[model samples]
Target chain A: MAEEKKRIQAYLEQLKNKVETQENYGGEITNEEARMDIRDCPECGAGRAYHKGLTACAYCGFVFMDTKLTDGVNIRKENNS
Target chain B: MSGNPLLEPIHGITLEDYGAACARLGSGLSEDDVAKALGVELPVWQEANLLWPERMKQDATFHIVTLFGQYFGQADQHPKFSGLKASASPEGAGNIEKIKQDKDFYQELEVARQVAYDYGLDGAQWIVDNYGIPIGDFQIAASLWNDQIHRDIQADYAGYNQRQAAYQAKYQQLFAEKQGGNVADDIEF
Candidate 1:
């Protein structure tokens, strides 16, 4: 019985020492690639501006930019008019 | 070695199971024949089953009401008649004469009424066979139709917005350079 108790005590001490000596490693933080996402309207801050080249907000009617939404793969063109 | 052919009991064989087995054995059988063999009730297919009779009724009623409303409005505009009545007075007499002359108008109304009734009764059999009901209610069907339309429009709008976003991102740099200066300040309204 004494030998069995001594064996258990030694195992427990080893486990405690191992746990105390263990170090926690964390993941590194990296910068995300910037992309155009929906942003709040600059004027009213209530409505969202989905695209960067929007002339005005759809909800608040706040003008965001002068660029006109033209046809083609390029959404906006210089509004010469 | 073949003396007597072994006979299996056919007591528990259902018609559907037999038909399936026959089909697997490459038996060329029509669907109706298969259904008949299985003792399954085949639904009566009809064109009327696809239409909503209530919708037709509503459409007819609306058209008739609008037509009458327009006629009354026109009659009201005349200075002679104060209200709708057939009398010896010039205004009333003239209105009655006009109505009597308009045989085409009365014929149109009769046609409309008949068409409405025919349309309402047309697909009744089909509805019974398909939906297990004689007629479907207009409001519920209309609500469902509108909901579907709304969802379709929303999905289309979402797709359009996604394409727009992709286009904007693709030419963001070019647009910024083209504007010469801050594009935000150049916007008037």
Candidate 2:
């Protein structure tokens, strides 16, 4: 029983030492600046739309695109079809 | 001014009665000026009448006449504006029917356009074809679609920030337990 307690104590001390030195293991993680695209309504000439492919103007009820804005991340491919 | 009906104290005066009283007074005002003067007094009388529960229904009748006259005047000045104004009148029952039919078509178009804007051209086309919505309506629909994606993305980002904060708190608690001092309190200069 005495040897078992000492073994557990030693393991705890090793974990404490590991935790203390763990700070140097990884570099600081920082948030990146977000990018945004803003555009104006063509019909009303007053309202602004943010995002690359917007469908309509909130003001004056103007529709900007016949197509829907892409869902999820938009990607372009080269060559093929 | 002694026998003037305009100045006479009456129990229940209406816009028409007031107009007649103004005419009897011989105020020498133009018809437009007389109407403009009565327009100012109409609301006051209506409001006072509204205070009496017995006259509430009469007040509603007065509102109907007032609104009709207001729109009629506008219709006389601008015939094109008369379409919307006429639809409000009982005489425009046919126009109301047409508007109802158009309203449904326009509503569907609006939804399809919104879907297209949210999903992209191919997505919008697929919806239009599958739904059998008129292609002509798509143009009108596109005009009404507003971008809500940025707002959704912003909301998602906020949630992410909240989750990040929770993770940070958990890390700090774990670090504090392992170390002698609270990890959050440890200042690095």
> What is the DockQ score of candidate 2, to 2 decimals?
0.01
Write out the backbone clash pairs for model 2. A62-B143, A63-B142, A63-B143, A68-B116, A68-B117, A68-B120, A69-B117, A69-B120
Per-residue lDDT of model 2, residues B1-189, tens digit only: 255333222223343344332322221223344323333222233432333223324554465344323332222233222122211234333332332346444444344445433322233343334443323223223222222323544779786456545655554454345433332243467
Residue A32 lDDT in candidate 2: 80
Cα lDDT tens digits for candidate 1, B1-189: 133111110111222233232322222224444334333212210111111122234553464333323333333232222232212345534433343344332223223333322322223232222222211121122222444445755879786466545544443433334323222433478
Q: What is the TM-score of each candidate against the true structure?
A: 0.14, 0.15
lDDT of 2 at A57: 64
lDDT of 2: 0.37
DockQ of 1: 0.01
Clashes of each: 1, 8
Off by over 4 Å in 2: A1-81, B1-100, B121-124, B140-189
True contacts kept of 2: 0.00
Model 2 docking category: incorrect
